[model samples]
Target chain A: MAIEHSSVDLSDAMILEPTALADWIITAPVIIPLIAGALLLMIRHETRFHAGIAIGALLLALLGHIGLLARVLETGPLTMTMGRWLPPFGISFTADVLGASMGLAATLSALVCALYSLTDIGARGRRYGFYGFLMLMMAGVNGAFITGDIFNLYVWFEVFLISSFGLLVLGSERRQLDGATKYAILNLLGTTLFLTATALLYGALGTLNMADIARVMPEVQDSIPAGTLATLFFFAFAMKAAAFPVNFWLPASYHTPRIAAAALFGGVLTKIGVYALLRTFGMLMPDQLTLLSTLIAWVAAATMIIGVMGALAQTDLRRILGFVVISGVGTMMAGLALGSVEGFSGAIFYAFHSILVMTALYLLAGVMNGLAGTYSLRTLSGLYTSHPLVAAFAFLLFLAVSGLPPASGLWPKVMLIRASIDGGAPWLAFAILLSSLLTMLALGRVFLLAVWRPAVEPSTAMVVSPGIGYAALLVLAVPIVWMGVYPEPFANVATKAAAGLTDTSAYIRSVFPEVVQ
Target chain B: MQTLIFRTAAPYISSLMVLFSIFVTLRGHNEPGGGFIGGLIAASAAAVYGIAYGVPAVRKALYFHPMAIAGSGLMLSALSGVFSIFHGVPLMTGVWGSFGFLGATVDIATVVTFDLGVYLVVLGSFTSIALALEEREDG
Candidate 1:
């Protein structure tokens, strides 16, 4: 195969000598939960111990991610090829700042979700091995983040998909089954598209290692199929991320699952799609993305408008949050479409913010549903008066997500606006502003109707929610407030991560040491 | 609905299929047949049993739970990867060990262990789902 690489000659690109002991950190995040999840499946007879094992595994993963992040931040990206094989030939898992940070966010969100599951998951869900599925999903998420091979990314996606399929139908309710069917079918389509694109990409570039493809992309002659490859990837990722046109599945199905299941999905699943989009477009295919930037910007605008409009029209609280999740996707997509350092950084920042805040929002929604005995806004009232702590978390998340000041969401919006103007697209900035307004308006309606509305006897339901659920919500909320208060450190990390995305020299050098002159 | 011919032949047929699956799994690292294929083959054996006899008979033939088997397979695969850490290599790094037994040398590799794990997981997961659906149908 004639591989045209306009970048540095990779013939000289040497693999880095594996660090003896510390390399385990790179694999720990994926392996710990995987082994735990597998073992948990064996002991399904004892449901009581599943939650503890899952939580412990997640905490270990989180610590590993934190360590990996710190190391990557201090050093550069850390790369390891499976079986100590050479790069390109071996599946490599690399943790750059962007990947590690996202991994950390995912692990944190998953840990909270696991904790919340202990209180929120019913006996039927537990009996069906919810914790085991949750751990497996976490392993998949971690694997996807750190994997350096595009093909491996697809594998991880499947792992998560299978586990999520298990989680989605854990309750086996009629509504859940209906939702899972739609979710499964659409996602399968997306997966097929992803695989086809990946095959074409490998055919064109003659390599599946992401860094190698990026290194060689400039040299590959532009063709119709090349353009189609980008479009295929866009559709595949967009469907998963629940972008404008293909977002119906999310709102249609998300609210039907158990609250913890929905919360996990809301928190990290779509964000994985977003992460893949940003990684591919921002890092691997920046030049191609620049060509399609205008179209992408328009998609961003439409997604933002449609998502908020959908949220505005929903009467169910979780459904409203579901729409809000879609709008958040649009916001990050707008940043991604700009295809600049500021834009990429903003997208990463917003992704972390979205993951945490969305999970917290859904957890709060679950709490509300538990207390009121229904998710319908028409029947639920006096939450602010009855459950002030829960109501406070909801209000904080609402403000944060609406891009209000003193919240982390505002800083990312500012960066995206700056990037839009800098990238010569003022209309995108206007779309973002307009979308934020719509989000506030839609979410404000919910606030007025559900929280501020007059007392309606407080629908005294048997709330079996344990204190851990509340604790999980609070644990997730802390990061949003902290990031909002002190944006500098986090922004610095994001800025460096964004630099890694745009300038792949360091990443390529890390993976292929021999290539560096 | 069970046919007399199927009931008479199922035991031998399933046993042979299970043996073939193990053989395929053991050779998967060097050849086309690995854990996934072996698992499918094994699961098919269970499926055949279910069709000829019933879900309960199939379940009894496979003493352990299908989900548990799958989980154990997953643990085995993960541990195989972790085993390299003890050798100061990256996770999933292939490490080989050989021992001289009498006049023959016995060699072992983590890849084969990992492959076996994959086989068990696939066999266990599919069979469990298949049994669940089939049992539900019977009820």
Candidate 2:
């Protein structure tokens, strides 16, 4: 049935259309983690077995995503409706190149984190459903990336939040409980805002399918309370993304959890918020986005400055990394604010690059925590002597995180800067460069204090054995260097993904097939 | 201390509620009663029984941890989708089949399986949480 809302143009309406190629692969990335998580909960006492299952499930999903990415890149977007129903009536799972690539990156990060958890997560944490919650969080991230409906996105967000809440409080320490309380309260507020926006949008549009909303947005752009809806969406996603003025929850709570959970959250969680922002503003409301580009640019600049300044003041390794992740969000937001093809492509590439780099950085932070028996920089030192490999990986990831040349982070910054100049927003470019400079100083201070200086007390001894976790960290580093050395293939994929986002007619057509006579 | 009269009636009342919950779950295919509501009904029945008997009694009756029930439900829900792949449909797409037993015809679909999963997951997770809280109070 066609949505016959008065605001929708007859020309834009499409009748009940069936999907062409029902690719089950489009849904596997989400379902695999979900099923694995459920199974992990069943086998809770078998810690080693749970670890194996978690890592295996993530690897399977990663492979599935790789194949799905290739297919989507080759044959446009893929769409499938649940329960064999048509698009509007059923929940639709649609994955374009962007979604597939993001899914791949997230799954890869999760796999590495799971591998690290083998050594890191204690028996108590394992008994408390660590792997289950981790897998659940991964499932939520993948589901959010692939779903084609707004309400479905909300459901996935809740899934992400609930699992993350459990994972955050896995240890049940006083600190963890405190962190979880703040995290749960703030995140729940964001969720409430999101649900409010969804209710309002559905009330106005009479449709919850994203493609249908995008098709009808132009018609109702002026008639409805578009600005308020847009603002609500912006705040909701911004709170989740940890953008400036609403990012305190991240640094506060992120450091309270164990390294594995922290690494997963650092890598994939907030990025989902960024992905949602791109999908909603970049695709669903291009006209409004164009109108608000200047506002977004200022917000981007402020987010970059505020986030870096926040990082500069932090002494805890995880907290510093947490703030750095926020700055990375600013960089991506800058690209999005530019609202150009080059800008969008830069944002997409940076999104994936940041995922890998931040996850690697956090994993290295875990190794550092092992080396010094704490996460505080004041108590950490002499890592270059005792554990050279961990120090080396941390240094390299820092360079990548701060956008130094010959690192993956530099390429995205270059594209974003170039786009800003061409798009007549050089100030945004300057904001990015300034943020990178400040981030370098902040992180460089971390390096000097944590790596160069001698230990505050030479009597402090290293804690645990660095097993395959170090290898897992190094494996994540290889892709960062690979992207830096050979940026062409990655750039091409990102450009295609950006093109798909800028033009959603293919996505719309894929999800809502042409109605046959 | 257990109230003799309430304790005496709890078993019969709880058994009926659980049976009613299953009926509600089965009718959810075309009616308003689905897995979530049915599961909540079942959990409340268990909670009422626990109030009369004790946390230990409810735990013994459940046999498996409530969280395990939730996990199994999740697996069932997800597996229902995987089954659709074998039928050459998209993920989570419903595939229907019919069978006759005892000279009566029975219809089944993947959606029903998914709903049953949801039911178990809700019933188990909620009851477990309630039991945990009630146990904490006792301790």
Clashing pairs in 2: none
Q: Could you give me the TM-score of model 2 versus the true structure?
A: 0.95
Model 2 lDDT, residue A191, Cα: 90
User: Which pairs, if any, clash in model 1?
Assistant: A12-A514, A12-A515, A13-A514, A13-A515, A14-A513, A14-A514, A83-B93
lDDT of each: 0.87, 0.87
Q: What would the per-residue lDDT of candidate 1 be over residues A1-68, giving only the tens digit for each residue?
A: 00121254543333335456886788889988998898899998788888889899999999999999
lDDT score for residue B104 of model 2: 93
Q: Against the true chain A, what TM-score does chain A of candidate 2 give? A: 0.95
> How many backbone collisions does model 2 have?
0
- Provide the DockQ value for model 2: 0.55
What is residue A58's positional error in candidate 1, in angstroms?
0.4
lDDT of 1 at A439: 92
